[model samples]
Target: MSYLVFEQVTKVYGAVEVVAPFDLDVPEGELVAFLGPSGCGKTTLMRMVGGLEPPSSGQILLRGERLKKPDRRRGMVFQSYSAFPWLTVAQNVAYGMRYRRDLSAAEKEEQVQHFLALVGLTDFASEWPNRISGGMRQRVAIARTLAAGSEILLMDEPFGALDAQRREFLQLELRRIQQEEGKTVIFVTHDVEEAAFLADRVIVFTRRPARILAEVDVTARLGASRTLELREGTDFFGLRNELLHYVRSTASEEEGTA
Candidate 1:
């Protein structure tokens, strides 16, 4: 069985069906992105996988084990700016390990340092949240999630709040962290370029009561290197345009029907 599996998963709220029955299976260490326009149920799908919300029907399994409820094994990053204003970068990361009474103080510190360095925020470890930029705060959020020992990371438009340059930089940073940690990631984004740049495979979805519309395999060869050259490469643009074309066509069809 695949590491993470969503089989005919659906979510309905009262009279409204937000996400249709959709199926996906991700191998143990793959990074996948969900791309679509707003209101397309991307966030809902991520929530379902994170176990924050239960599926109306169907199943979600990780490592062949069924996910019954939210647990520490799955981490999440939201679009909302989620850093505690009072906490320093290191403190923020340490917050995740608070509930783990089993770990000694020294062990928790080691985990915090490891994840901070993974995201290139070791220098900012003592800096307050307000002292750094939005991008940096988001990095802290990511590091905190990682420090919690979650093997699966769920990101919902995590970079949507940053400027273009920062967003792009963080995307590369995320890719690097994913590589180093070998974490299973399901990232949700509306940006086609973001999906193309970061994902091993891009899954597209339809409008509300969303279903998987298409899937594109992004085969960029960049490893842990975070050079701007990856974004400018022919493969990047090619894959990005393909996803954009899918979104545009879907939008056009919706307009015609309206």
Candidate 2:
């Protein structure tokens, strides 16, 4: 059985359907990227998995259990700065563990230190969120989610706010963390290259009332862990261009209708 299941899940606001009846299966420890145009319902579908938005119909299942309300088990990292301005870097990461009943205070502190070191923020543990750069703040957000014991990460363009260089760096950072933490990630992004770089599999979506356009397997051809060097390789382009073809075809289809 698949680790995560989107069994005929859908989203609608009033009479407008943002997502059509959709179905997908994600395996454990795999990073799946939803790539599509703006307002294409990719994020909407992801939100349902996180339990942030209810599916108008169908269900989101994790390990065969239905997900209903927002839970710390499936944490989210948003595009905007999500760290608490008043909290220090360590505090932000530790904050998520406050509600973790299984962990003692000492265990929680250990987790905070572990994640802070994972994201290379151990030195800045005492620094405030407002004092750090945008990229650093995002690192804090990721650390917080993992420290809270969220095995499934729902990332909604978490690095989208950063510049190209910073974005690339964080992509690698996230990839490393995912590899080490053994987390299942459902990433939503508009950037084709970013999706290709980060995802083991990429699911392309059409315009509003989004439908699955294509699913391209990247790690089958590309290496398990991607780097800047791979970006210029033909194998990488093949993975990226394949996703681009599906993305562009959707744009063409929209234009023809209009």
Candidate 3:
């Protein structure tokens, strides 16, 4: 059975339908990217999976059980830097663990140290969120989410605001962390290259009411490298172009219909 299943899920707002009946099965530990043009409902779909937005119809099942509300099992990192402004880096990373009754004070501190080190923020543990760069704040957000023992991550363009160099750096870091931790991830992005480089499978969506236009498997094409070298290769560009084509075609179709 799939770890996460969307059973005929749809989202409607008044007379406007954001998502059509959508069905998907995501296996455990797979990184799936939802790629589409703006207003395509990809972010809306992520919100439903995170349980922040209830589906207008149908159900989302996690491990064969209905996902009813926001819980620690699913962690979300939005495009904005969501770290607490007043908290130090360590404190921010430790924030999520405070909710867990399973760990003692010492254990939580250990977790904070471990995750801070994992994200290479150990040296800046005492610094405030405002003192760090945007990319570092996003790292804190990721560490905090992981410290909460979340089984799945819902990232909505988490690196979208950063400069190109920082964005690529975080992308590699995120991929490494996700792989090592073996967590299922649903990454929402409009960038074709970002989707092609990071996802095991890329699901392209049409304009609202959004539906799947194409599902591309990129794991095989990724080969042994997950670095800039891979992005520079011909196959990577080919896959990215294909995804772009699908997105453009969807936009063209929408324009014609309008």
Q: Against the true structure, what is each candidate's TM-score?
A: 0.94, 0.97, 0.97
Error of 3 at 11 (Å): 0.6
Worst lDDT run of 10 residues, candidate 2, spans: 249-258
- Model 2 C-alpha lDDT versus the unseen true structure: 0.92
Candidate 2 error regions (>4 Å):
256-258
* Total residue pair clashes for candidate 1: 0
Error of 3 at 224 (Å): 6.6
Task: For residues 11-40, write the lDDT of model 3, one tens digit per residue.
Answer: 999999999999999999999999998888
Among all windows of 10 consecutive residues in model 3, the one with the lowest summed lDDT is: 220-229
Model 2 over residues 139-204: C-alpha lDDT tens digits? 999999999899999999999888999999999999999999999999999999999999999999
In terms of lDDT, the poorest run of 10 residues in model 1 is: 218-227
Ranked by TM-score, the better of candidates 1 and 3 is 3
User: Distance from true position, residue 35, model 2, in Å?
Assistant: 0.2
Q: Model 2 clash tally? A: 0
lDDT of 1: 0.87
Model 1, residue pairs in steric clash:
none
